[model samples]
Target: MKPTFIKKGIGFAIASVIAGGSYAETTESPVSKNQQPNVVLIFVDDIGYADMGFQNLRDDIVTPNMDKVAKDGVVFSAGYVTGSVCGPSRAGLVTGRYQQRFGYHDNIGPRVRDKNVEQGLDLSVKTFGNYFQDAGYTTGYIGKSHDGDDKKFWPHNRGFDEFYGFNNGAADYFISGRNVENSEESAHSSIHRNDEVIENFDGYLTDIFGDESVDFIDRHKDSPFFLYVPFNASHGPMQAKHSDLQKFAHISDPLRRKSVAMTYNMDVNVGKIVNKLEQHELMENTMIIFMSDNGGKPDNNGSINSPLRSTKGTTWEGGIRVPFAISYRGHVPANQVIDDPVVSLDILPTTLAIAGIEEKEEWELEGVNLMPRMTGKVDKLESRYLYWLTAARSAIRDENWKLVVPNIHVQNPRYELYKISEDISESNDLSSQYPEQVERLKTEFERWNEYNEDSRWGWNKDRYPYTNGWRGRE
Candidate 1:
């Protein structure tokens, strides 16, 4: 089975428009080889596409800093993460390879004391920090380090020169405590500076990350640095500062009001970092990439991915697709919206390319260097396939066509096909009318699945039943 000629033509037309024209014309390049810009990746946890003010899906939420980032950079309208969940999505971003390839297909559960399990990112793969460190950049990580807690899996060992933040999936904002039961009690969730845990931290976690990020920038302003700020603001254990909550008193729903407060707090902190960059005169040379790890879990966090279907742990647009933008004051064009499909994996390769590093054969990066297309050096990206797999479902997207297959236990255990180009909301399923397309996508997914290793750790069936696949509307 193959995509119809007309559908192929339509896909190419869409791609052409997204690239800003046919291959005949070009625009001025925005990159400079001599000046190696500092890289700052601001990765937020569980932020929905509509939550940010720049997305224009929600009028109530105010995120001025995030809005400014979009205004100053190129926004990818069809941006996505490799996974619909946190751990795998981050794994793909850091390594520039599908997490499935390394057996990280599911979220790493709470740490188990007895069983010997490799819960974090695979030790074999080199992270972005590793590459940056090798490239002579001072790499520092601040905020939630959900990758792993094992001594070997720690961020410092993973090539980051300095590390601060919890090593678990979620933490209490006001105070830190381990969520696991019958485990050796320690400051497991407390903020850590390098290896020492800082107990009873004075302020909100988000503010703490912002202050530390500014300090990191100030300390390394004289030299190039790679700072990864993965804030855990709006994740779970929904807690917000009293002042922030008071500001959002008009919000009728308590959960939503709290979430908005947390978002406001995050935005304020982002502004602080931006101000620090300007003060230190690093704003122009620093390439800032801001994105969420995955879509929000509305049920758990009161996030709304408006106009998109499903949420968080699903293959729908609301899950994988997210708010993504890149800003480098003098290099990247400002206030441009690129509708091309770009994934989180591209972050690693794009950053490396901007840093004047050639792709090494040993790196095996699945993501492409987006600089050419981004700078209008290339009209369109070469066509590629994007695949996602979890224990309960699998999905494959090629060009504009997307096919999702849910586990038999799911409420609607059937194949879903959508022309995502025409229907971003995924309200229509054309599988019944386009069996050939479904077969083609399914075959592509099967071939890709063969390249992936079986998950090292399986999802707990008792905790999350198969029937409860994704708690978002399709």
Candidate 2:
């Protein structure tokens, strides 16, 4: 399908006024009477609560482009990632089910060379892209694909028609030849057209991804498409071009300065893609989702999750809570903020629902569609139990109460039950004052645990035992 531009004639004045600008041209793609809207999932890596301009961050970091997305769509003030880390959190997101359900509660097993092993998304579970592809949507994945232990788990095998990104855990933004390996032709920072490795090209990873993403949208503008762009920015091994870092030179903390500048680059790239969609007249029919894999790695990334206790790899609100927004012109509400508890796992089912894919027969999907809640069709999200276990730690959050069993990797028991509503930073523990509430939450956690096969499947080791962190540090 191709879009045609109309030329000015007798009604040229009215047309030009509506167009507003010279490029305000109208184009139409042939639709099959019923076509699903395009879907763009922009998943950012390791970002904190105060990382963006929309989240009321007091920091000097500039993210006006990301803020624009929140302003144009609905931003969820209290959004959580299922896990406190990347691998498991991504597992929860792509599958629309709790990571524990498929024994993906931890990061990919040991990273060893010549292990002759590939780690990635569970080969068995159906991904969001699989459903979209089944329904005839052109699915493309253009960044960070970290699942777990098998080659078949890559995006190409997981149902994406086109895949272009790294398959390993993390790669240096520069010097791609050393880090990346693709099945197709190779490109620098290791470029892979499909499954093959191509030659590396010289450019910023963020910019490369953004440019490729815009081109993908342009190519698939006529057809329904699903674009998954997961940027590995604001994460570890902080690297930013000298020009980007100049903006944050005043910050004494070198890591934080570079991280903040990297964030600005991320924001700029986001603007680039969004503007591309708008220019193509595809914004109205496209659903754009922006969220992070998990919270920030403050120590390494210079991220500050203020009002949030602890940092990434912890169960604290700061660890799991992230900035999330959804924008679909005219369909989703504008400049709205949602406080209802939601998680990244909900994206699959929600996006699938919007794409009109029926997975009602599948019992594995644990997430409910959030589009209704965002659209004001529901007063409040249904009360449901949410559980998170990682690195031997366990946390159960139900309603306004949350129970945290810290330091699960060590011996000696220490527990804190905080009323999150009253203490979002998890400051005060009401466990002693409300023993009954604690017991209730505990029982609920156990019951949820019972339904899963092996939440602690790889927890047999003594170093990171399940009950080690249940007790507090000395």
Question: Best candidate, lDDT-wise?
Answer: 1
lDDT of 2 by residue, 1-474 (tens): 111222111100011111111222344553343567889999998888778777765557677776766777888877888998888888888888888876677776543212232334557788888888989999999988876324477788898998888765565677544434432322223456665765656688888788889789878877899999999887766999898888678888888888888888887888778777777777777889999888887887888887678888888887898988888878888878887778887888888888887867654788779888888899789997778988577898876889998866557657788877556777678778889988898899888988764443233444333332211221
lDDT, candidate 2, at 74? 84
Candidate 1: tens digits of C-alpha lDDT, residues 1-474: 332321111010011111111111222323344557899999998988888777766766878776776778778878899988888888898889999898887776542212454567889999999999999999999998766556578888999999988777787786633322212353446677877766454677888898999899878877788999999978988999998899789999998988888987887888878777776667778888989999998889988886778899898888888988888887777777777788998999999988887889888899888888877888778889888887677888877889987663578669999887767777788999989999998888888888887665555645333321111211
Task: Give the CA lDDT, 0 to 100, for residue 166 in model 2.
Answer: 73
Error of 2 at 156 (Å): 0.8
TM, every model? 0.86, 0.86
C-alpha positional error of residue 83 in candidate 2 after TM-score superposition, expressed in Å: 0.9
Model 1's lDDT to the true fold? Answer: 0.78
- CA lDDT scores, all candidates in order: 0.78, 0.74
Q: What lDDT does candidate 1 reach at residue 448? A: 82
